[model samples]
Every structure is written in structure tokens, then in C-alpha cells.
Target: MRNYWVRIALGALVIFTVGMVARALINRGIGGVRGVVEGSGPLSIPLAFIPFRLGGDKLGTLERVTFERTAPQSVSSVRLEVKLSDSLLARGLEGCRLAANLDSKDGHRRLSESTFWCAPAGSDTALVEYGQAVFRPGEVSVPLYLPQDLIDELQDLNFDGDSTPISEAEIDSLEASTELSVDSAPVLRARMGDSLRAEGMRRADSAKGVPSRMADSTRSR
Candidate 1:
């Protein structure tokens, strides 16, 4: 009887280990963040597991997030809290820190964060944006960083000195499709529900390198 129990325990351990290995292998996508550089400062000396995606679009919104590593843990999904660096903010987030809270590959998307520059010099003003997705089964939020002035200038027809996007109509539709992650991670697309309609079309919060383009798109309004 004693030997039987021992064998059962070992079997369970083996199964668990195999599953964990599979998970890691599938999640290698974390490395897709080719241009970013991340370090485990808040995490334990050795990380049990950390997954985050990097890279940005035209505006540079931090295709990822940052979180603190709670020493270590077994295989599972969790939110790792972390801090943003001044360099990322100044350098324009082309490369920076990344943190995430999710299981293995094909895992659900959760919280994320990053930092970006506000202005050139004497400009300490920075903006941070956070988003969440309430899937049919669960809800998740991704961290984001964008320029305030830029968002306003491009998203709004009045501020929008360009013409690539909506302009004349009443903005009857203000939502996003799966292919459009206008202000979030590259892997995840956003579905902005219809609520942005205002008197004339409220200005939207533009990402860092976006508003300027919007203006450029136009004749300079």
C-alpha cells in the first residue's frame, strides 16, 4: 500500500511537469518583442515565469505592460506589477520594459503598461493609458502610453488637420474592428464601443507619434 501511494504521487508530478513544459514552449511568443529590453528588478533573483509582448505602431503606444514579480510561483496566470523607466519615456518606447499576467501561450490577455516621452526638454508631463477587455468568459486590461496633444489633434475633426480618417459624417460609428488596435498592443485589437459621439465629435487621446501625422495628413488646421 505504501509503495502504491508513492507511485501515484510521482505520476502526478510528472504530468504536471509535462504540462508546464508545453506551456512554456507555446508561450515563446513573448520573445516577439524584438526591439524591447526588459529586466527583472522587482522580480525575485530568478523569475519563475514572465511573459510580455513588445513593439509598437506608428504612434508608439507600448505594445506591452510592466508588473512586479512576486518572487516565484508555479504555472498559472498572474499580474506582475512593475515600474516604467525614464529612459523609455524619453527614448520614445521603441525599446523598453515589459511585464504581463497570463498563462502559457494562447493564454488570455490581461494587464499591461509602458512609458513614453511627453515633450523634448523641460517637459516632464507624461501620459499613461490603461485598457481592459471583458471577453464573454473573462475580462483583461492592457497597459498603454500615448501623447495627449496628439490624440486630441488627430481623433477630433476640429483638431484633426488631416483627412485619412473620418471627417464629414456625424461619426455614426466610432468603434474598432479586430484588425485595428489603434491604441493598444500589436497582438491584441481593440473594440471601442459606441460612446465617443459628442456634440461635434469629441477629440480622442492620440498616441505619441500619431497626432502630428494627423495634422500632417491635413493642410494644417
Candidate 2:
């Protein structure tokens, strides 16, 4: 009887562990039901328990978050770290971290750093620092446009980068980086900083600066 009871308890423990693991995976997927709950409004996540693990190869994720109001307009700080995979049980989100310091009252969008990749091999790297951004609320969508010269300041960006009036394609790319909340602007606005750092702006620093068209669009809006 003692042996049988032990076996039953062990089995129950295993089943409970399995259920928790399954629930975490299902809810933590990006855009998966989990993401919607954790990554949405007010930045506060309410659930029974949030188990956080590490991902070192494929994708990393975090959800069901909460924020304490530090100031009137700012949420103080936000941090997200998780790992998912292009393939199941894939290695994990190696060397992955995302940080955002947003000031909605001031319309400032700052993305500290984003590094996603496999351990020992960085697939993608994006970093922003040393400056600030101004944002404007849009009707259909909230669009964040660079100060023109700032985009050009990014190391690799063409001072004349298809200066075609901030095309929709560019906007879409930025959106992928910045979402509706958590900065609420497209990423292109911030990635420009990465471009500047990557291109070693010091080498090709231009007095001519970014295109004038940049100003027209930003001001017009």
C-alpha cells in the first residue's frame, strides 16, 4: 500500500508539471493567445503564476506583464525576455534581451538594445542610445518619423535613402520593431540609430546631413 501511494503521488506530480509546462508554452507564443494577454493594455499581467525560463537559441518571449506608474506619462520601465524557436524545442533565444524606456507624455521613444541570435553567433543585433526621439499621434495609426538628419546620421543609411517621403514599406518595417504600445511607433524610427552605429558614422560623417524631404514630411504631419 505504501509503495502504491508513493507511485500515485509521483504520477500526480509529473502530471501537474506537464500541465504547467504546456500552459506556459501555449500562452507565451508571439501573437499566440498568450501574447495577446500579456502584451496588451496597461502593461499589467495578472495570472496565477508566471514561470520565466531562458531561451538561448531560437526565440525568447515574455507576457502577462505589469507596470508601476513612475511618473504621470511614463510607466517607469519595461523589460521582456523569453525564448521561442523557428523549430520546436529549438535551442532557444540565445543572448536575447529587449529594453524600452518610453515617455508618452513627452512623445519620446527610446529602445535601449535588442539582440537576438544563437549562442556564439548573433543572427541580428539592434542597439539605440545617446539620443532622443519625438513622436506624434496619428489618426489611423500613431506614426513616428525621424528628424530626417537623424536618420541620415545612422551609419549606413543613405543621406539620400530613397528619399521618397517615408514610403509605406519603410513604415511597415519600423512597425515590426515598435508596436502599438511599448513605444507605439514603427521601429524604423529607432533602428536608424542602429544603422548609424553600424555604418560607423564617424567614417562618413557628412555636414550635408539627412535629406530635406525628411523635414517636410515630419513637419507636414
- Residue 203 of model 2, lDDT score: 27
| Per-residue lDDT over 1-221 for candidate 2, one digit per residue giving the tens place of the 0 to 100 score | 23322222222122211122223333334245444322323333322111222121111233222332333223333222232222212211111232222222222233222322112223223333222211111111111222222233322212222323433343343333333222322233334334323343332234224556677779999
> Native-vs-model 2 lDDT?
0.27
Q: In candidate 1, what are the lDDT values of residues 53-120, reduced to their tens digit? A: 23221222222122232222221122322222222222232222222221122231212232122123
Candidate 2 regions off by >4 Å?
1-43, 46-62, 81-94, 97-221
Model 1, CA-based lDDT: 0.25
Stretches of candidate 1 off by over 4 Å are: 1-125, 130-138, 159-221
Worst 10 residues of 1 by lDDT: 131-140
RMSD of each: 22.5, 23.3
TM-scores of all predicted structures: 0.17, 0.20
- CA shift at 43, candidate 2, in angstroms? 4.2
